[model samples]
Target chain A: MSNPFQIPEQEQHELDQLGAELRDAMPEVSLSEDFHEHLAAKIENSWSIRSAFQNNRMIRMAAGLLVMTLAAAPVAAWVGIWPQQKKNPPAIGFEIPEEVNVDESGGALGDSEDNQVTGPNDEFEAVEWSPQRRVALERYNRLVTAVASYELHGQDMELARFEGFSDQSAWASASEESLWLEFARRCAQADLSPLSAELVARCTLMLAAPLDRNASKQQRAAYAAWAWLLEGEQAKAADLQMNWPSAPFLTQN
Target chain B: MSPSSDDLLTRFAAGDPAAFDELVASLGPRLKGYFLRQGAQSSTAEDLVQNVFVRLLQNASRYQASGRLDAFCLRIARNLWIDHRRRGGRVFSSEEAFDRADPRPGPVQEADSGDRAVHLRSALDHLDADTRELLELAVLQQLPYREVSVILEIPVGTVKSRVYYSLRKLREQLHNLGPQEDLS
Candidate 1:
């Protein structure tokens, strides 16, 4: 009896013949050594850049940052600084300092009293506060703590960003003051600079009151306060602010 | 097959640029010819080959020599081609397209050296891109119906029938072209 599943030998022969024909028809192409030389050169050009990015140490650091950012909340909770869950969102009871005295005096954190902060060529003043400014400072504190807590996990940086650290909504609804402060804090803690410095400067300006009132005086205070915060030099910042030739932009609430 | 392409790849990853060079040199011409036969202009074929190497460079660290290098390389080429088509429609003339479409087209075309290359290439132009790719992989690649099924992400049996159906269509197209040049 003939096999049931077997393809007829004749049909198989035709297939083999066709397969052979197609194989023979395939074209032969060769690469010139010139191409190889060019490729080698290109690789050499890209080598350093790739090596810089692929440095095992940097990759490990980035990976560590990612893990930290993702695990921050849990870690923070474990350390007893943050809440375990958001069953009850905390009420907005944070205080905004009236004039962030940037003069060189206070605690290990820095002096809070002398307040005579000044700016370039006496153009900008030291410390001045507004309702909006207060919120910003509080937000900055929260994000700082968040990042510090995150760093404990040793995760990658990009992954941290992916896991909602970069989500605008996390800070968007925050009072403009809070948002600016948080933005400042993020800049400060970031591994890189330029953008952070600019953001800090912008945050100070946005919180400044209408120019007509203290006008020249207010500018000096804003700059002094900004300079102090960035350098972690509070006493001098405060001293510069106190020397301002006009009234403060903020009043204690 | 050969030692796992992945093993070769891992060696390349261990700073053996020579290994990478050899890999590229060995695969380069065939890949270029594969694209060219499918109707890719020489420049287009060159671009595709270059892109494959560029990708190899970028993902060298991720290359797993345990897997089939041919499959991995083919997968990369296939993805690039698919993306190219998605981004800018079809790239090759139908014959060249058919010739370039299969991961194993070089062999397929080689096997059927007679009038089929010209006739099939021409006839292939009449079919949709997907059908042409399916037929090329099945008939030319001599890929088991199952492998074709896996590569194209389709049912196994579908490959055989599709291959059979596409060949029939190609033959019909050849017939329609009249008894001009014999693809004997």
Candidate 2:
């Protein structure tokens, strides 16, 4: 009911004085022509090194792929550990069987380029590249990776398969989950709205979607809380306040 | 007419060092002022200003014309400052360098000037990097928070909050340390 940021009148006065002082403390600098030449030369030297290091296309693409994989892996595992279940029950639309195969059969298409699983929505196509679509795909990938990492195999493998991303070949493995988490966290923390927003959206979707038996009850609940936050459902988020194992780092608490 | 900053960057990337000279001519003063406002000594600020432009030359190919030119330059400058700070050469103590060591006209040395400047500099030093950078960009350089956010890799909301908090802190410190102002 009360505003937390209400500064007292006295404090406000103090702040005004500080502002005036701040205005006066700033320094003045003037650049000369000779200094500019020296700087240019230094930069030229650094560029030569950078060019030498990243000159090849294969190296660059490989590096990009490595970063993507590392970033996506922990997310897959986290998703794997989370629970899932079909929403709307069997009452609304056709419910796919819970035991659909992810890798070999046409289930959630195991992390391969060939397979494409059809979702409940008849019109919903596979991941596309528009801003919204990219966001959606990134979310899906992250959720799949997190769930997969946590041990939800089917959906994990399914989402990966659908997205044509492989845990084994794509540079994301059990060992690299920590690195991926770091990358994702750093990227999300920075003002990369497209990346962070997608992370939020996918996190929401993963939370909103029903969880399966293998998924971590606490992680699923946390995802649900995360989803609730994304949906502006703070009340529901408050309700799912379970003591999740992925407590400290994952929730940003 | 001399090439614009953007034009020089493009030409420099195309291997024309002369274009780089034009860029340095155009952006040098602005760069120098940015470092100075962040409390660098004039000579030190000038050095870093030159370093920023040279760093730009190395990374010229990375510059996209569609991107914010000023923000790009500022980001490079911020990185250079961080590096200089990390070298353990420049810290809060370096604030005195700005006030006392610059070659140009600096803060007036009235009876209260030294104390006032010292208090303000210390307050800024106490602020977070994001807050300090935003204040430098927004207040000192007169840039909008939008561009500051881009350069600092923070959201506009964050930029606003940081500037507000840093300013609040600075003002509080100033009032505590400087001559009292009438609050009528």
Candidate 2 stretches greater than 4 Å from native? A1-25, A43-49, A52-253, B1-4, B11-19, B36-44, B92-94, B104-108, B112-130, B180-184
> Which parts of model 1 are misplaced by more than 4 Å?
A1-7, A32-34, A41-61, A66-253, B1-7, B37-39, B94-117, B141-146, B180-184
Candidate 1 docking DockQ: 0.13
> Tens digit of lDDT per residue, candidate 2, span B86-121?
887554334555555455444344324454455566
Docking class of 2: acceptable
lDDT of 1 by residue, B8-117 (tens): 57777788867777787777876665566555666566667777777777766676554556555656777777676677744667445444444445534543665545
DockQ of each: 0.13, 0.28
lDDT per residue for candidate 1 within A140-164, as digits (tens), equals 4443433433344323333224221
